[model samples]
Target: MLPYHDAALPVADRVTDLLGRMTPAEKAGLLCHAPVAVAPDGGLVDEPRTLLPTAPTTHAVRDLHLRCLTLMAPVAAGPLARWHNEVQALAARSMLGIPVLVSSDPRHSANENPLTSVPSGGCSRWPEPLGFGALGDADLVRDFARVIRAEYTAVGIRMALHPMADLASEPRWCRTAGTFGADPDVVGALAGAYVAGLQGDDLGPDAVASMVKHWPGAGPQAGGEDAHFASGKDQVYPAGRFDLHLSRFRPSLHAGVAAVMPYYGRPVGVDGLAGVGFAFDPKVVAGLLRRDEGYDGLVCTDFGVLTDATLADGTVWPARAWGVEHLDRVDRAALLLDAGVDQFGGEWCPEVVTDLVAAGRVAQGRVDESVRRVLTLLFRLGLFENPYVDEGNAVATVGRADFVAAGEAAQRRSMVLLANDGVLPLAEGIRLYVEGVDRATAERYTTVVDHPEDADVALVRLDAPYEPRQRLPEAFFHQGRLDLPDDRREHLCALAATVPTVVDLFLDRPAVIPELAGHAAALLADFGAADEAVLDVVFGRARPEGRLPFELPRSMAAVEAHPEDLPGGTRDPVFPLGHSVEALDWRPRTSEPQKG
Candidate 1:
């Protein structure tokens, strides 16, 4: 047996042996981490399936020698396990027999954004990350992560592209639902627990390597815009709180996170730093993350930074090269390598690395340095010994009854009680008028009425306000104004006048809701709970233990006036951070507020 194949040896020794034996082409492939789509039957898609360009899976594995890949399709556990084994079998036929390292974005949440998270797809569903912040319990967050690790590893996924360490300081940022909260202290603790739960003290076959993302924080985008589009490229520090943003990452780094992902936003007006994307900024990646912070783990860039392409509908999807868009592809790739990024996400260009080394633009030593880090992680995961997963085991382990029950319990616990006027616990047997809630679910609790005027109480479910952009993919991100629409606001107030109304607001982002606060008899905020879970909290079957993770501003004007980089800066919040009222029947255990 080869030295690298012997599991008894030290991981470092195995990595060193594998790195020395790999050819330049193989090393180049290690730098490219491309996306792969799964067919309906769980086979690899040979044809183009999505807007993002991807080579056929077989060709990417055999011809390009690519070993790292991300899943683009949301498939069930059994199918995904079958596909994983197929990929590993093909990879074993390669000259060096390197096992593929599969990774995925958060797939267990109810928020199904195509760019960020996938649908549950038969996996145990849970609330958004904001809910975890609301609960403010590190132990619960770690327990949730343990379930994630188990399900992911069952399907042969070794890397988790999650636990976004970026704080949700800016309210209008589209990705706020993915973060823990605005407070660095709270987010840091939860992120550390998430990393520890996934990787434990060491990463092995049973553990999934956690990749804490958007290094230096992507939350403070100027004007509350996201970094995904050109108009939102600038990450401004108006409060001069750049260092404060970095505080959220300290605990994750301290926990020995397996990977770090630099964001697409470029820092504006920072001292002694270039105004460029974090992945292309040597000062940020090499100096701040590597040298200053003393992190030596894998550094991967966020998706599609090296090249631009067109969508199937002919929309120009610009490369997120940001400040360096003027530079050509080769120069951009070279600059990113020099910036200390070890892997290129959403990129399929292994030739760029090979050609750069061949032309002497990038030294062989530099290539070897990155190759070593990638191989080290692969070895630590024990992929060489056992890369395939049992389909039956995956089917049984994923979405197990216990796991589903735990997730449902968390969803109920994460609902924050914002207001109560002696009208909650829903008074046993009151006639109900429901909107946006399923009739069957409401009927189980009490009588369901057709109109608010005929009912004793009204129960309405409302989504937090967002203005949709007029672009295809950009519109997918919930951005723009946070205030409720005039029509919806007026309609709600009119209904409340007819009967006492109980509102359940799904807070993907903090909403400006002074009118709702004044009109609704009771208000509860949920991150991503099911209809049953919401009812469980409303009917007092389960008590809401969540605190507000972010401030709910009284007006959009207040949100605009607050510094994007600073937390707790809203002038007149309807509900401040950590604010939550108890149910009418809830007995107080202590005078002091609960903290995470």
Candidate 2:
């Protein structure tokens, strides 16, 4: 006997009534998630046998009501329609008829990838958030959000875990591409517009719920790196820098974001809270977010991260920090619940939660609290109103021509001019040499050259190292002890020696900018969409108006002086923050060909 029936009632009260009737096993079921098809059969993680156990095997609607299910993998365009239909059918078979809440990581772009998760069926692959900030156009930000919302809603995805509001304070952070910029005001305004575009005029039915993430902030990690592993878990905020980071979140919260996600890093010294990550700390989650901030929305933990874990990639690791490995999964769940985490993102430990209740290690009341919050979020998202999709519109709505147009516009706006030595806006018909341009993107520009010597104006593109999968070819992820590897450095140096190179480094994180002080003609760096828009700026089709969003450290040593000690940590960037050189007028020194 669940509590309330009318969907129109307040979400908290409705959830409260429903939580009172659930059995311990049913409450535990809400905490577990099964992985579905990550991609069509033949791609990475291709074993169907590996995936079968994760598929939704049975619906426990009647006996013990199941609340929600997060999809494991992304479904293909052709099969997505069928998949949604099947998922809806599963819900119908359940006792409570609760529709599954399908969600996903950022799928609107190709940059962040293992490509193991589901691909968005319909949506233009917009430039990453850093690119959006470069545009500095609020309307485009709104449009990008709307396009993502349309694609997600069309495909039966009710919630979007996106519009990462973290600022790019630490350039070495691997996830810098996902954030807006270094300034909190800029990130806040753009992020809010993105939220508005996703949710629409009405907060309830018209818009998809936006989950603003890594609450408080995850930007200031010890080293500009992810906090997931032990090496980069400490977060230090001196003299209340938290207010600067909180600037972005405040707007999203006011705009009625549906949920918040805390990061994995532990914080040091704030209001008697000694050292604790927000995910496992009641002071951070309940005290700050829920109590002080007045955010009534659901709070979920980051995926596959727990305070303690007995398993490591399916193998056991020795007992680690915080007594995590020693504590069982149930105890971990209890800690999360008490700390005010409403839902476990991509966690697969339902049996442990069940065991805890049976053993009386965890109270039934606490389980009910988390379950209520999860259900409340689902209901607020309007999942129950109509959970099935039309299927026919899935492909048509996603990444359509209009959406691509919007993405292109955003890409153009984000281009910032780093340097121009009167050689830019090359005279019409001058041969242009470009390295690192993809075939499709190159076609938009002049012909790409095999060697820089053959062309009149040489352009090259570079990016910070990002290994898409957890297991990358050893050559890419690192070299010796520092971030950039030897082979990549050698390759770039070879190209710089060949011509008066115009280098465009995709400045997501500050990498070791090779000593091209005398080697290259001009250097231009940008945070987003470096490949696509660099061509436009090169030929004077578009003006380079962007400025460095954050400080570019000279070397890894300089980065170490800051809170998040990054590789290439030196304070002297080849070009400092806000450094941009305008295109200069040029005259050929001599028309005569010189000996190569």
Candidate 3:
């Protein structure tokens, strides 16, 4: 039989055939993802460049049909169109003529930064996903996804690495606001809707693909934390306990997500396994995802998270524990390939694999398998048929009025009214005292006041500080639980006494509201959002329809209760799961007027 890479057949057919023809070294090259840049001198620059890089030359590596290109966000339609044109041209140069896939992280939101691209040119800044979850409207979620899809597709971003399916069980999880909710059904349903909207009826080149992520549930870190640090990196899905978290992901997979990006956290019992990261784990990626669940989609790793950088002494360490330790780049490649990963997202390490082949450490056959999978996905995405778009369309398509409306709508829905003393639905034209409100958001309500003493009603928005207490490191904050020193609590108590405050906590995890509960006239909680929409809920312009998605622990000790001991398990939280109070009609005190 002819090998998979042989040129005499259709591109897809050739990819399959060529897989058999190539050595493992060649196959591994396809799994490596890198930013595509034009070499200043028209040469292939393997390393990323600081300059405005153009697409790679089509003729330079015609034989090596690259699978995907990772692009930064806020990219305009013109540049995107040029990228598509270049990729298509490259595909045409090859005998198989396979197109290249383009991907990016959430770029449609205000939080776009190094991890994501944001064009100085206008793009609608939607409130984060947490606000959408608070709204409890699946349709709104779909609308949000649709707008994002239109914006991404207009700019040639074919895949959206979003709708983070992880449960918001841990409030301190940095990415909590990106998820739908803590309930399996809620997260699952919303995630499915998001995927459907993104892919739509037409899974064509113009439609964006969804990469729902942090598989097998990333909410439960060792201490209710992020999985990046070695101390907090292990994932514990105790036997029979996997279902609690896995429920959200199963629905997303069923919803036909185009890709799954396993987190960098090491799964329990993954030690000594050939592949360190769950991204390269057979049990998680191959056995569970492919076999048991029956998902045959592409699997990509989180960016800059797989392998450690070279040290001053030239030693390469694992970037995360889930990443293989003590392995050279080639060995890591071999492990990932054997474990069934389709591609490496974020960073080009193809040279590492190529070097391994040259040193005879890796078999050529293994590389071919990965390459075939990568090519298959790109070809399926229809990148070859439609590669480029007009630059003008990029800015024009982003942040459209409809998109902004959807974003605002999502923000309104996500606000949850935790408690109301019937002082809400403020009468129009009342002076409102606001703290921590964005200047623009406050302009709509009342004159910004330096002190709450002169204001009619005091409103405050406080986030769990990202900065750590003097004694505690910042990592403690990332973990949902914080054991504040008594002195710190005392200091907070002093601050609370100054105002009859309406406190709003962005609950990433359930914290003790009672600590400062006495000082506030009313307390409100939300997963995440800007202050304007939050104020809308405060004044009852929009009803607080949100219910508590997870249990709130009254105390850290209550949180420590066994998961079985609690409603779900011994893990009893201070606030039981599903605790929510409705906003009541409040007539302002006779002396104090209601605020708008």
lDDT of 1 at 246: 85
- Give me the runs in candidate 1 sitting further than 4 Å from their true place: 584-596
Candidate 2: Cα lDDT at 151:
78
Candidates by TM-score, descending order: 1, 2, 3
User: Which digits, one per residue and each the tens of the lDDT, describe model 3 over residues 1-596?
Assistant: 35433433566785666555555444555675555543322233344353322234342235444556665434445555555556656665655454566676676554423333333234566655655655556887787777877777776678877768887655445556567656666778888888988988756666788888888677765545566556666665433355566667876787778888878777665334343567767777777777878887777777655455443244343366355656655666666656667677654556666776677766666556556666666655566455665657765777677776666666556556665564465544545566567767876864555665555656777664343423212222334453345675675565556545577777654565556565566777765556766777766666566676655555666544433101233244444555567655533222344333
Q: How accurate is candidate 2 locally (lDDT)?
A: 0.63
Query: Which candidate leads the pack in lDDT?
Result: 1
User: What range of 10 consecutive residues in model 1 has the weakest lDDT sum?
Assistant: 587-596
Error of 2 at 240 (Å): 5.6
TM-score of 2: 0.84
Candidates ranked by lDDT, best first? 1, 2, 3
Off by over 4 Å in 2: 1-21, 32-35, 38-67, 72-74, 115-122, 238-240, 269-271, 307-325, 439-444, 447-449, 465-498, 526-532, 565-572, 582-596
Predicted candidate 2, C-alpha RMSD? 4.7
User: What is candidate 1's lDDT per residue for 1-596, written digit by digit as tens?
Assistant: 99998999988898888888989999999998898889768998877888656668998998999999999888998999999999999999998899999999998887867889877767898999999999899999999999999899999989999989998989998899999987778999999999999998788779999999999899999998888999899999989999988879999999999999999999998998899999998999999999999999999999999888677678888999999999988899899999999999988889999999999999989998999999999889889888999999999999999999999999999999999887777765677899999999888877787977678889999988999898867878899899999999999999999888999999999999999899999999999999999988887788898999999998888889988999877997999999999654753121221111
